[model samples]
Target: MRMIQRRIRERGEREIPARLIGELVMEALRDLDPVAYVRFASVYRRFEDVDAFSVEIARMKEAEVPGGGDDPNRGD
Candidate 1:
């Protein structure tokens, strides 16, 4: 919601594009929780198979945040 609010403020409360709103919501979910992000991304991006899930997860693993993001597959 903060993202949307910020965009609204930036745009002087003008009509925001649905695509931008969706992207912001997805971004907020990603920052809040990986599982949630994946869940939303799957639906939003219309993921159709395990391959899509794997790809999104792999992309997340690669973009791991600093001082966090332990490898889920490495048994850390």
Candidate 2:
């Protein structure tokens, strides 16, 4: 992760492919413990502010909504 960050910083404005980043993350996570994955994701996703983290969580919750509503039991 630090290597990726350093690469980006050293090569400013260069485009890094999403697939490459995803592959790198997956490889890194494969050897990491669950808690380490969470820690890495929190920083990697730039959840520095509470609102940013809240927005990401809300997006996840919304995706879980089958029919897109406040109902708890509905699957679709």
lDDT of each: 0.82, 0.62
> 1-76, model 2: which lDDT tens digit per residue?
7866765567576788776676567446635554464455567776778787566556555655676557767553
Per-prediction TM-score, please? Answer: 0.75, 0.41
- After best superposition, candidate 1 residue 48: deviation in angstroms? 1.0
Candidate 1 versus truth, CA RMSD in Å, comes to 3.6
The segments of candidate 1 whose C-alpha lies over 4 angstroms from its true place after superposition are 65-76
10 residues in a row with least lDDT, candidate 2: 30-39
The lDDT leader among the candidates is: 1
